[model samples]
Target chain A: MSVEPLNNELINNELIKYESIGISFGNRKVLSGFNLTVKKNQKILLRGKSGVGKTTLLKMLLGFTKPSEGTLYFRNRVIDSKTCWEARKEIAYVVQDTDLGEGKVKNLLGEIFSYRANKEKLDSEKLWTFMRELELEDNILEKNFQELSGGEKQRVGILIALLLNRNIYLLDEATSALDAKLKKKVADYFLAREDWTLLIVSHDKEWERDWMRIIDLETQSW
Target chain B: MPIYDISYTSLIFCFFLLIIPIFISRKIRLELEKSTLEAVFRMSIQLFFAGLFLNFIFNLNNGLLNLAWVGLMIFFASYTAIKSADLNVKKLFLPIIISIAFSNLVILLYVNKFVINLENLLDARYLIPIAGMLLGNALRGNVVGIGDFYNDIKRNENRYLYSLSIGAGRYEAVIPYLRKSLRAAIKPTLANIYSIGIVSLPGMMTGQILGGASPLIAIKYQITIMVAIYVSTLLSTTLSILTSFGTAFDDYGLVNKELYEKSS
Candidate 1:
């Protein structure tokens, strides 16, 4: 019947959508009238100048920042205070500055894994594999997180995202401190996963790929 | 033996001791002369009133009146704690007042009943001063605990949000900060416990000795009071932080920014 196709179309696969989004600090409008739609397994690299609200856009999905105007949707449901908490459980967010407080890296990771939703997610075998792939030595986990080099700290953020095993990734300048080779390796690692949805805000050119869809906020219509 | 009282002339001699500190402040350019004089003046006036008020309360010794005075102390203790912690006093006052009252009253009665074995349990001499000591210590603990907890979360907000994003419930994410703040709050009390007898004679023990009690009895009282102070401080600080959680954080688990007093 004709109704079957219509119902199939209505079963929307859009995982995240931002409609007419606007953000302002005081009188300055950092972002205005922006729109974006991300389908399942979509890889989006948001490109914009510094202070253009790319990070704010990513944080809006997690309810860290509220939009001054318009609506944001996750799985076709409006992302409010309640739904945002549920959305956070499914998204792995790697902040630009990874400050895990004053503690040994091992203990910090243990604390994260101890969360109810994150329980039993700490796979030591997978941790070692990711550490080796990220070029982090075994002894690095013993060092204080605050004392690690910028690149090491950034990788730690990335490592946490990987360890979370969530499908949706929000990377805000996550690889800025890494070298070119590691950047490409990290980019490739994330891009190779066809089932993962990535919303990346990075300035590195290594993330540019043939299959990736880039949204340049500077040039996009407001 | 009878307790000796300082005469008005002897108290004047006590006021004269300030001249030495005033001279030292002047020589060292510590700029404390005015504050030193003002502090001495204020202490004299405040203690003068407190002595008179306490004298009247002790003579009456009505159970209700003694409890009422303790209640007033708890109210002021809560007010000063929030104000000193640099939080919005109006927002935090209710929870803090309740917490201070609950923790101090429970410990105070427990000490009076079980330790001292007081039949009246509301004797002004035992109740008011013990309440003062417990409330005073708990007030300091709450200031350090509540202030550090909120400030730490605000300062390390990204780390907190990272935990939240990784599927941490609000309580789970805050547990780290809670552990840290509680430790900081109790550390001073712990240090005092360790250094109490050797480094200094605590005020209560000194008072008892001055009031013609044996050193042995004074030490016993000092030990008991120190233990009581430590336990009540921990209780109040923990309770203050836990009770304020509902108001201090929004529904999204983010700290309520308005609860923080704007830095002037």
Candidate 2:
């Protein structure tokens, strides 16, 4: 719910716009011609009930799913599977139970840092700074992911998304297991950042205050 | 005179051999008796029919007919490979067929050209049974290879997607699973190869000895057959996995949900 005020310098045109976006799973319409407009540096709260297509909408936006009809635009370009990476390069998504694979946590992070796309972009100092800011200790990264607590895993996922440096952040129940103090700290971290745009899917009322606008997806036809 | 047919009493005695296993299974509360019985019966019937057909084909001694019979064996072997692997025939049948044909032909021709040195390469005595044995082994190996690979990918899909997110191409992402599946499929054959001289005599060498071939000739044929099996195993495993990859994933290299078994 932490809605950072839109910074005038960062605000260019709309970062994303969904025009007549519709999606169906087999016979049922999960999202029916849904539309939303997101400007840069604005925090959007996507509140919805379970199975109301909140996850589906995010996947469609991420190009993992296709809209049966209508269109999606990202930075004024049509968004589809082919061009989804263009938006993905600027977007970071965090979800519960993010699969880390069979490896130590640090190895997973190392693989990401070694990726060709991020080889020149990631710096060791910045990764350490982000880890410290997120309150993640160094030893946790050395342990196997199977040994981690739920909160620790979630934080690791957050750290990964943070390292990606995508300007647009999509958080799907990202803080569900955190303590109230830590939740507020996380909310403030995103809210206080002027260069980031965020769309948050959450049930926590504490986050509501900082969000610029609240969009209730539950009331709409999915 | 009749090429050593089994007597009725011997057939009846063979049926009684099932009694020992059946009693043991019942005492142990094992549920495997039904499948064991069914498999034994099916195998007996199939082999009986195969022997009868081969007797006719051998007597006819026409090259075209012999070739057609070998073709039938390959077709049935490929079908059984698909069935036992529980692969969807429609989606994977073409790749399996192509891989089987490619691997078998490459090894079969190479062996004929260099090792056997028979003028009539398509001779029933030399080609049909040898091709059958080589293709049969390849089929079994591929069933395990392809099945394990697809199952591994399906089970670890989220991990696979994670690798893709970290900027791995599909092949690089899938290499771990492929290595595991190939090793699992080939390990048994490799072990058998190592155990050949020590543990047991191979069926081909034993058969050749019984057929009155010289021991030296029998050993050479046995060695060549093992070599062919090894080469075909390697070729088919690689070709089948790589060829099927094109159909298993979407255009973006993401796995297609429909291509994988629903249960897996």
Candidate 3:
């Protein structure tokens, strides 16, 4: 508990580790004895069917859900409410449901970037460029988020996560609603960031590239 | 001039007026007759006993006993607020009680000591009636405030998690919700304040006027009580929602599902 966070000078390799994590909803077992180790800059895809707890796994990183069984570690330390707070600063999680906020898209993004940790990281230029890459019109930012198209909302969710300037990401079906070409485009954009570690949960085949490690959670039955 | 007391015969004539609403409900198929009757009967019994008991308490006017009566009011207010919201009272009782009691008591004392300038702050006439006005409004505020807050959080849970994942502290993540609920809570009170004289004569003003006070004095009491109700409500509803945070969520900042009463 007294251990100080490791200095930035050292080689900080380990990113996240799930050691024997398990959870159950009533008597039904969802995930049990789940184990995984994620290292820095290692792009990984988590593949599983619906309701099999793939999203739950990503949520664990942000302390959105607690494991009924084991410990989750970030940077060689156990993840808890406190650690998740710090980890969320460096980790961008784009939920499957991009009903991320209400009101204007620009305002939503503005609020997110207004947090103390992300205050300096709000770059309008970068946001516009990302929007342009995602084929989102400038007017979309002025539009109400609840009124946006599903694909447009997905892109916005991904766009905000990318703009957070974080090195780690957890994307839960983050690109599912996009069309084929746009899926490839979005997948390519994330993959191009070599230093960014990604834990992606998607049924879309666009992300099934050779370079990214795919962990089919179905096979492991975590 | 003093008001005339209604004889039992006059009161019976008043009961005859209830037939209009009952007949209208039956004619229009409004299905409100049973509820209307129940409400009338309940109010009649409640007020009759409350009048008798308050008369006794006013004559006695013991400080500790008066405080105990106010405590009972606070407990009932909290219970009704939580129960009306269909929440598990076990989880919310203490927080709501503490909040309502603290806010109502604080304002009640302030009104007695500072506003009314009474020598005996616990004088039953001032204390009981003033506390009732404050607690009644606070009750409405809590029902809206805490209820709206938790309901919004439950419905749009993903929105909350989205805020959390954006590197927001718990307070920061929950601020939007707090703002939203607080706005919902204060709206009725503000509207009441706004249209106090034009739209309707408030009960306090009417009661004071009928009780033989000068209209000017009645209006003054109305003004002070309105301000008191608004202040107490703001404090109580805000306090209830804030203090509920102690139990509403776990250490992870996720709302405890157990806090809500499960549907039958």
Better of 2 and 3 by DockQ: 3
Query: What is candidate 1's DockQ?
Result: 0.80
Give me the candidate number with maximum TM-score.
1
Candidate number with greatest lDDT = 1
Give stretches of model 3 more than 4 Å off: A1-12, B21-39, B262-264
What is the TM-score of each predicted model, taking all chains together? 0.97, 0.80, 0.92
> Model 2 off-target regions past 4 Å?
A1-12, A23-31, A88-90, A106-122, A140-142, A204-211, B1-42, B56-68, B115-120, B212-227, B260-264
Tens digits of per-residue lDDT, candidate 2, A60-138, equal: 6666677788887877777765667655556787876676766798877776666666666667788788888778898
Taking chain A by itself, what TM-score does each prediction score? Answer: 0.95, 0.88, 0.91
**Clash count per candidate:** 0, 8, 0
lDDT of 3 by residue, B15-106 (tens): 88999999999999999999998998899899999999999999999998999999998889889998888777888889999999999998
Native contact recovery (fnat) for each candidate is 0.78, 0.24, 0.78
Error of 3 at A42 (Å): 0.8
State the lDDT of candidate 3 residue by residue for A61-89, as single tens digits: 88888888999999988889778888888
Q: Give the TM-score of candidate 3.
A: 0.92
Per-candidate RMSD, Å: 1.7, 5.6, 3.4
Residue range B1-264, candidate 1, lDDT tens digits: 888899999998998999899999999999999999998899989999999999999999999999999999999999889988888888788888999999999999999999999999999999999999999899999999999999999888888888888888989989999999999999999999999989999999889999999999999888889999999999999999999998888878899888887533
